[model samples]
Target: MNYLKPSETLSELFAGLVVVLTVTLAASVLGGGDEAGATTALIGAIGANTAWGIIDASLYVMNATFDRKRQLRFVHVIAASPDEATALDQIRGELDPILESVTKAGDRDQLYRSIYSTLAHGEFPARSGLQRDDIVGAIQMFCIALCATLPAAIPLLLSSHPMQALRISNFLVVGLLFIVGYYWAKYVDVNRWFAGLGLMSLGLILVGVAIALGG
Candidate 1:
């Protein structure tokens, strides 16, 4: 399914890494860096990520359905409008959020008119319902969220020393945060290194806050 955008994938991974870091750090703070602490952290990370993945998947399905309905509604509204101006207005309202910042009013109007022309001739959907593509996208969302736990979780499992394992896990998650941010910057036109370091710093700050707040 061509459903999961790069931005969405990056967002899930970024959030998941922050959550894992926060959970592990809180466990270490509360459990005193013992075997128990490592065990608690590992379980917490797994459970949190799994739940988050499921939640995101559910939301993906919901959004897919809702978006379909919205599209149909949009088409109907365009078809029902009394004249071209109203239909153009409807299209402008829809396009404004995306084009407002980067484009001039004239450019947006041209784009809106172009879209209006196409939509005027397009047929509205007879019905809206969930499809296979939606399900596939949901599964993709879930997989991305769940897989995000692996880099940190594997290190925790591999080391015999609990403190060392926790340290390694933190390091791995920070690196993952940096990597995600580096890719994220590509879309935003930011300096890659700065974005990477900034995300890592933000992740650490969030974990620290979680620990301080008693997790």
Candidate 2:
């Protein structure tokens, strides 16, 4: 159902890619990319990232639920306000930051009034729970994370030498980081060239840190 924003989906993929890339690089450097070390690194990367994917997916659900609860609370507050002015003030205070980038001040004011009218007169259920769409979305998130590791896996499966496979995987992961950054830039309406290069650099720095810590 595409519950995640483009940025969020990119972030998820980036996280998984960095994780496995770190494991692979750390093992290559620390263990001299030996047969046993390479095998261990592959296994560890898959297992650890799989666990991370599940954990991140669950966290997404929690965050989504929290957002829903927050919206409901805001609605209830607006409904219980003493006057229309007070309700509109509260709504504007809570929503202005998000809408400000895309909407004019007059447009935002009108939208807020419309929202105030609808929410003030509406009925909402008390419980805030996960929905079917939420579950589907979480599953989608997990799958994206898992798929991010496939590029790294292919080199490992095809290359006979551990060092060769690790180098290929490293290149693949770094390229992917840039690709995702490019898309992220386009999504956010920025310069794609700078975004791609900047993200590739940032991702390598982050992976180095993670490897150092985990090593």
Candidate 3:
């Protein structure tokens, strides 16, 4: 049920943050320095990112559903065997990597029986049931994406000068991207400084593209 681990959540948070920041900065730049322009930029960025987040989360849920169906099919195949011994053999053969550490005969037998019963009865056991975690993870992802818009939009919402707001938002986002990249690299056992710079460069590229496209 663990659809997304803590590290994955952090990585997603940073990625979403950078994306929203770039878009908001572009919006601020394109709009003129006025109350109406600032309001438009802030509202546009928030609304766009919110919609994107929902769409992204929905796709994740759909993909997870398909994947779960595939896994159930595999289970059905194993349960279709004629005899207990054959079923166990099939399970061991197909899922050896998963059961390799289960050295105890009793444990293996329990696992085999559990899988066979669940598939044969068309009732998945608690642990093997449809994962609620996927739905929860999707919601969390959506929230992260939506929340990311706020930081970039804050300056635009508060400041009268669109250009000044854009500059501050750009700087804030770049700094955040570097910090996220550094920690992410450390988590993955990579070179932190290089990763930081790399992500920062990527952010800049995205900003350029957004501006060129007249976002």
Root-mean-square deviation of each candidate, in angstroms?
A: 2.4, 1.8, 4.7
lDDT of 3 by residue, 1-215 (tens): 44676675666667676667656665565566566766666777688778878887887788777777767677777667787778777777766677668667688778877877667666653343347787897988788778777777787767767777877776777787887778778677889999889887887787677667764
For all candidates in order, the CA lDDT equals: 0.85, 0.85, 0.73
Q: Which stretches of candidate 3 lie over 4 Å from their true place?
A: 1-3, 81-131, 213-215
Cα lDDT over the full model 1 = 0.85
Q: What is the lDDT of residue 139 in candidate 2?
A: 89
Deviation of model 1 at 95, angstroms: 2.0
TM-score of each: 0.87, 0.92, 0.71
In candidate 3, residue 133 scores what lDDT?
81
TM-score winner between candidates 2 and 3? 2
- Worst ten in a row by lDDT for model 3: 121-130
Give the C-alpha miss distance for residue 121 in model 2, angstroms: 1.8
Model 2 local distance difference test score: 0.85
Candidate 2 off by > 4 Å: 125-127
